[model samples]
Target: MTERKLKVYSEDEAKERLAKELPHWYVEHGWIRRRYRTNSWKGTLMVINAVGHLAEAAWHHPDITASYAWVEVRLMTHDHKGITDKDFQLAKKIEEVVQWQPGLEGGALEGTPQDDLRFAYIKYDKPKA
Candidate 1:
């Protein structure tokens, strides 16, 4: 099959989309990036695996930088040579899955305990004071 041309967003358009739809993501050097802070290596691995799954499922991989306590995901369309809808879509899915807070929903799923750091993995972003 012939490769279809993707709509690559300009820098300004990318920034605007990020600000409106994905406040946590930022556009930089032709890529949209987001850093997720974790509590330990376990958390870092979890984040990486989650991102990998999403990227693979979406068929749009990201450049992942992972350390003991954090993971930075950078998305861009290589074929298109810029940020495209695929990047933003994958970023949103990754954000939703990686930062999910089931406990806050008051459902049967009680998310990991915040009281204990041992059980905790990802260091979720707290509201600014």
Candidate 2:
């Protein structure tokens, strides 16, 4: 099947749509970006893998930069030469998958020592409890 031509969003349109649909993401340069902070290197790798899978499935890829404790995801429609709806859709999916916590799922953490492992969920620096 032939792919539909993507429509690039104007700067104002992109900013407005992003503000409503993806408040955590911001437009910079020519891309929409969001940075996820992980707890460790393991968490960073997990985020990268998840983003890779999602991007592959969507057939729309993002520029990813991963470090020991953070991953930056930048999305733009290279074909359209700007940010488009495809970017927004993929960004939303990435946010959902990355924010998921294994401990919140039913019985998934039973008998597992949670403190010893860093999961893929985005977390900020906080005081130890």
Candidate 3:
């Protein structure tokens, strides 16, 4: 498979694009950034380590900072000197491995809410009881 190149975009343009790629997070300091707050430090580190593994395997890395209950990730193409599609692709993979649902990207990109929230389909975060 051919690697997808991240299309570079301006700061404002990136935000608009990010709405589609990552509705919950936003671009900061010219990188795709997200902050995750968990209940346990151990869980956070584990997730960070897992993400690190994936990044290395993909040959595309995201800068991650973790301590206590928070893990922050920043993705940008240093070679490109800005953001690119690689950042978005890695974000998608992270979402899958981490068991997270991308935030509302302004509007529906697929089927209904029930369809999007199919418990049988998602294995990460469980529905609140």
Candidate 4:
């Protein structure tokens, strides 16, 4: 099937949609962005891997930046040269996978049993005072 051209959301529309659908994410420059803070470097790696896998599966990639304790995901449809429904869809999927927790859906914790004891489960860090 031929690919339909992606619709680019206007700035106002993007902000409005994000406010309602993904309050945690904000429109910045030309991209919708959300930063997930992890407990440590190990947590950071876990987040990066999850995002990579999801992005690959969806064939909609996001610009990712990882640090020792956080991973920032910026989504925009490069071909459309703006934010599109594809961006929103991938962002939502990323959020779901990033926020998943062990035992939440009978899913086993990632990594070995010993690693589980040593590596802290990835979590969104609280904002600093």
Highest-lDDT candidate? 1
Give the CA lDDT, 0 to 100, for residue 126 in model 4. 40
Candidates in order have lDDT scores of 0.91, 0.82, 0.72, 0.83
- Tell me the TM-score of model 2: 0.81
Prediction 4 TM-score vs. true: 0.81
C-alpha positional error of residue 4 in candidate 1 after TM-score superposition, expressed in Å: 1.4
TM-score per candidate, chains pooled? 0.95, 0.81, 0.70, 0.81
Which residue pairs in candidate 3 have backbone atoms (N, alpha carbon, C) closer than 3 angstroms, thus clashing? Answer: 6-84, 6-85, 7-85
Model 1 scores worst on lDDT over the 10 consecutive residues at 120-129
List the lowest-lDDT window of 10 residues for candidate 3. 114-123
Q: Please tell me which predicted candidate would have the highest TM-score against the true structure.
A: 1
lDDT of 4 at 120: 64
When superposed on Cα atoms, how far off is each prediction in RMSD? 1.6, 4.1, 8.6, 4.3
In model 2, what are the clashing residue pairs, if there are any?
Answer: none
lDDT for each residue of candidate 3 in 52-105, tens digit (9 for 90 to 100): 998999898888988776788899887787888778888878866665445433
> If the candidates were sorted by their TM-score against the true structure, best first, what order would they fall in?
1, 4, 2, 3
Worst ten-residue run, lDDT, model 4?
108-117
